[model samples]
Target: MMKIDLQKEFNDYTQNLNKASKDQHINTAITRAVKAYRSTVAESLERFPHTPEMAAEVREIKTQAMANNSELLAQAMASVERNKGKAFYARDRQQALEIAAGIIGTGKTVVKGKSMLGEELHLREYLEEKGNEVWETDLGEFILQLKKDRPMHILSPAIHVPREQVAEIFSKFFNKDVPPEIAEEVGVVREFLREKYFSAHVGISGANVVAADTGAMVIIENEGNVRLASGAPPVHIVMVGIEKIVPTFQEAMKTAEVTWRYAQYGVPGYVNIVSGPSKTGDIEKVTTYGAHGPKEFYVIFVDNGRSEMAKDEKFSQALHCLRCGGCMYECPVFQVTAGHFGHTYLSGIGAVWTAFVSGGLEKAAPLVYTCLRCGRCMERCPMQINVPAMIGELRNRIVNGAAQGEEPLPQVAHS
Candidate 1:
């Protein structure tokens, strides 16, 4: 293996961080987003005062879920198969990509919902490379797709792209003079993706929580894109992390509720619970598959390092994250740099995720050091993940080299 240049990585990361911190678009967008998130989350908490208590209960649920992750994974896959949906377990990124490609094949148009997993696996880029046209249906994701940029926030992918820039991107893409009006911009994209939804051969999404008992994939979304993307296409494919599975449906509901609540959504516009392919029994009182919705449903449970993360006691809590994006609002570094402080994931929590799931420890070194360890993010985090503690453990491993027989640690310079 090529030796990683820790000095160069730190220098380049710092340069990017400094540059991002000074960007006017990132400043304006993050400021507005932080304010809105705080206000909305406060109101949401007040409206549903039970959320914190529910979150506490969900924490236990997550703890147990992580402990029995292997059992839950097997049960969930069996439930999916029982429900008539094909289930796949991908041990790594390559296997995940290959399975999806085998199902999708080449020369197909795919409309996909917003999925951080998709970003982690570079699913869209991979499919396109395999000769498929893929469209990101979420408005923010669509904007990023057109702008050729990655997500700046988990919930709000293009959070750094202000409306002015959006209008510019929209104008260039649509080949028209789209003004800097949010409504008009939305209308144009809505008009464009409406056709892609019905015409696309496949639709892809990520689940917020999975119920091992019923094989249900619960997706919480404010935007209606997931509904269309999953419903309109003949084939619906769900790519979710194995850590999302819970033992029971009721616990899954609790998990989903807490997730949306902390995500600043008082009540998400859509809570889709998909178990299997759409079916009907009308004509002769006989059951039939493929009504007006998707005829085929496939679920790929991606493990790509998540299993390893769950096994380690110090890092297992990181897998409990609901991806609410609330911690980013409270994170001082994230407030200033947005997603520049991250790799595929963002903020303090993201650093832990990058270390385990998306990118390994070496890739996560810069982000690990970026954390202020003020514990402000914990105050806002629904999971109350001890990110500072995790960061400290990562730093020790980086400095002293990884545990016996693990990947050799890079030579990182002390500040």
Candidate 2:
């Protein structure tokens, strides 16, 4: 199990975030996330001139939900258990991190929301190896969690460091001389995540869509830290991935208006819509639960192989992807391999979601032949989603390819 070096593992995750790829802060964050996702896909195709006829009606509603994925995932798990939401269907990734660390039990304090399915289910090192003080609150995942480092971009996680090395890792982890300035390292990570977004007690997130006719769980961020990690923690998880569900809410608001114009090239003024937890009864308005927010709102629907790529209609159009990091910065091999464009949902549709949620194409088959099939990721794919002809059609359906036997990727011995 060795061969990983996709550019010396992103130059040792940018030298362990002491941050020095001064190729001008990852080319100024891949030129500001590709000029704000190409001015939000040219202002969402000029304020929706039927974005290529609603991306051919979301590719025929993902061609009849991947042509019947177990009766559309049992009608999206009975519409998230008829809206009370407690679905838990994990088929892998350590049983969805032991059912989200057993519904966040022991001594609380989680607060997440930057989720590449909670960092491919590492889930904050398994809830800090069961001790719990999670906290990622997404300012590029709080500067790659103050330099422990891993997310090099699933929508700008410390896009290979360079706000003067994030003002020198916030002047040596907040020992205080910080002024190299990128809006003062975003006001010292917004004055240290506004006291962990009001004293966290468990509020994870990751659901860019899950509307099965309004079980309603969608979040298309511009950073209100996923509406304060699913609204100020009263226990609000959402891990999501049953191909992020869509049988409605107008096809999950056209997959969150083409996933925020394919990740901020525009149109994001907070499109949140989280239907559950945030109760109020104010003077006989009655029917209450937790007047402020998040009073236990779980929704862990994972299916780790995405039901074998939803019964394979050519890897089920990679489950109609909307994780929209814009086919990883328009993959010229992910603009020359940033975060090695293969794993945690990066380029070539994150090598078809790491060959069906972490296992396929074997060490992701030479990162899916470094995709220069160059359809230019289907001309900034809103839903044009070709992904270099599905990584040459899942590298001919992985018959000893995308590497598990090819070897030669090991490098990093820089002591």
Candidate 3:
């Protein structure tokens, strides 16, 4: 085994954090976003007083789901296959990318919805390297794609980018004058991605939750891009983390509802539940697939160190994250430095995720120490994840070298 030097990693991360703390764009954008998020979430909770109670129930569901993850994963895959869809399990990032590339051959166009799992695997860049033209259909993701920038927030990927910067990005990409108006900015992207949605050979997305009993991919979105992207193409591919699966459809719905409520959406514009490929039995009692949607469907359940995290009692709770991103707004370090405070995942929870999923303890060492441990993030987290406690445990591991035997996953660089 080789010794690792974390001093330079720490120094580089510190420089980036300090630079981001002083960036006017990040400060202004996050300030506005935090204000709006707080107001919206408060009103949403007030409107649906039962949301917190439901969230508590969802927590139990997540706990049980994680405990029985392997069984549920097997059942979910079987259900997908039974429903006329292909199912795959990727033990690591490389295999996950290869499976997707095989499905979508070279020189094909792909339109994709926003997916953090996709980010964890660096899917878009990988597909592009394989000779495919991939277009991000989500508005914020589209902006980041054109600018060649990484996500600044989980739910709102380009939260650090204000409308003015978005206009500049759009103008440069489209070679036309785009105003800083929010509605106009959205209209241009809509017009541009509309063509890609219908013309693309494959469509890809990540699910908010998966129902093991029925093999349903439940996706919650507001932009309507997912509907077009997944429905308009000849092939639809779903790349989701194994942690997203639940035991039953009803439990899945409860989880999805709690997810949206905390995400500042009272009721998301769309909640798509796709079980299998499109089919119809109207022609003389004969069944046929591809009746207005993708003829082929595939689901890749990725386990890039997730199973290891699930088996560890001390850190299993981190897998319960809904990715609603409510906690980031309440995090002091995150509010100031935005995504620069952490890596692929952001903030305190991101630190834990980076250790188990994205990067190893070496990459997570700096982020683990950066946490202020004020407990504000826990108060806002719907799952009530003990981020401060996790940070403390990670620090102990670093000092005692308890993580020495663990193998680090391949690093995926984010801009």
Tens-place lDDT digits, model 2, residues 47-146: 7777667667877776676676566667777776766667778899899899889888676788788878878877898888788888788887777787
> What clash count goes with each model?
0, 7, 0
lDDT of 3 by residue, 1-415 (tens): 5688899999999999999999999999999999999999999999999999999999999999999999999999999999999999999999999999999989999999999999999999999999999999999899999989999999899988888888998899899999999999999998998889889999999999999999999999998999999999999999999999999999999999999999988889999999999999999979899999999999999999999998877789999999999999999999999999878999999999999999889999999999998889889889999888878778878876766335343212110
The CA lDDT of each predicted structure is 0.93, 0.72, 0.93
Q: Candidate 3 local accuracy as lDDT?
A: 0.93
Candidate 1's TM-score reads 0.96
- TM-score for each predicted model, relative to the true structure: 0.96, 0.34, 0.96
lDDT of 1 at 321: 95
Q: What is the lDDT of candidate 2?
A: 0.72
Off by over 4 Å in 2: 1-74, 77-112, 115-136, 141-152, 168-187, 190-192, 195-204, 207-228, 231-287, 295-312, 320-336, 339-345, 351-389, 394-415
Write one digit per residue (lDDT tens) for candidate 1, span 1-415: 3567699889999999999999988899999999999999999899999999999999999999999999999999999999999999999999999999999999999999999999999999999999999999899999999999999999999999989999999999999999999999999999999999999999999999999999999999988999999999999999999999999999999999999988988899999999999999889988788898899999999999999888887779989999999999899999889999999999888998998888798889999999998888888888888888878778878787668235443322221
Q: Output the lDDT of residue 168, model 3.
A: 90
The stretch of ten residues in a row with the least summed lDDT in candidate 3 is 406-415
How should the candidates be ordered by lDDT, best one leading? 3, 1, 2
Candidate 3, which segments miss by more than 4 Å at Cα?
403-415
lDDT of 1 at 13: 97
